[model samples]
Target: MTILFDQCNENLAAGNAIKLFADYKVDVLIGPTTNIPALPVFILATYYNVPLITWGMTSSAVLDDSPRFPTAGILSVGSKRYTIYVQ
Candidate 1:
C-alpha cells in the first residue's frame, strides 16, 4: 500500500509521523523510503514496538543483537524472515 509522508524538517516531521501510522494500525513500516530519513522512524518503531523493515538501511549496526539494540533484527540477506518489532 502507498502511504504519504510529507517532506519537511525530518527531525520534526518524521518523528510526528509515527502517530499517523499508528492511527491507521499499519502492520509494517516499509521505509522512510531512503537511507537517511529512515533513522527517525526506526527509533520511533523501537519506541512503539512497531516492526520496521529497513530495506534501505545499510548500517550493519542493526544486525547486532547484543542486548543493546534488542529491537533490531539479527538476520542478514538470504533469510526469509521479514522485519519484526523486537521487544
Candidate 2:
C-alpha cells in the first residue's frame, strides 16, 4: 500500500490536493484530520468514485453514505458525534 500526504492548510488547499490525488488515480484517501478540510475531499471522492476515510473529525454525516459522499466513513475518537458538543 502506498501512502500520500497533502497540506490542506485549513481546507483552503483541499481542492487542489484532491485534484492531485485524482490525477494520480489514487484508490483511496486516508484523512484530513479535521472535518473542515475533509468536507471537500468527501465530495470529490464521490465525484471520482473513490473511498475516503477521515480520521479525528466527528461528523456523523459521513456514515450516511449520501449521494454527495456515498463511500465515506469517519474514524473519530471523540464521542461528540453521538452526543452534544459542549464547546
Top lDDT prediction, candidate number: 2
Encode model 1's per-residue lDDT on 1-87: one tens digit a residue: 646663534575475556656677666665554434555665676777666665543344443333543444423431222433331
Per-residue lDDT of candidate 2, residues 1-87 (tens digit): 555454545455465556656677777777766656776766777777777777765354444445657777777754544555545
Q: Pairs clashing in candidate 2?
A: none
RMSD of each: 7.7, 4.2
TM-score of 2: 0.64
Q: In model 1, what lDDT does residue 3 have?
A: 66
lDDT of 1: 0.52
Model 2 weakest lDDT span, ten residues long: 57-66
Which stretches in model 1 have alpha-carbon errors above 4 Å?
6-9, 12-16, 57-87
Pairs that clash in candidate 1: none
Scored by CA lDDT, what does every candidate get?
0.52, 0.63
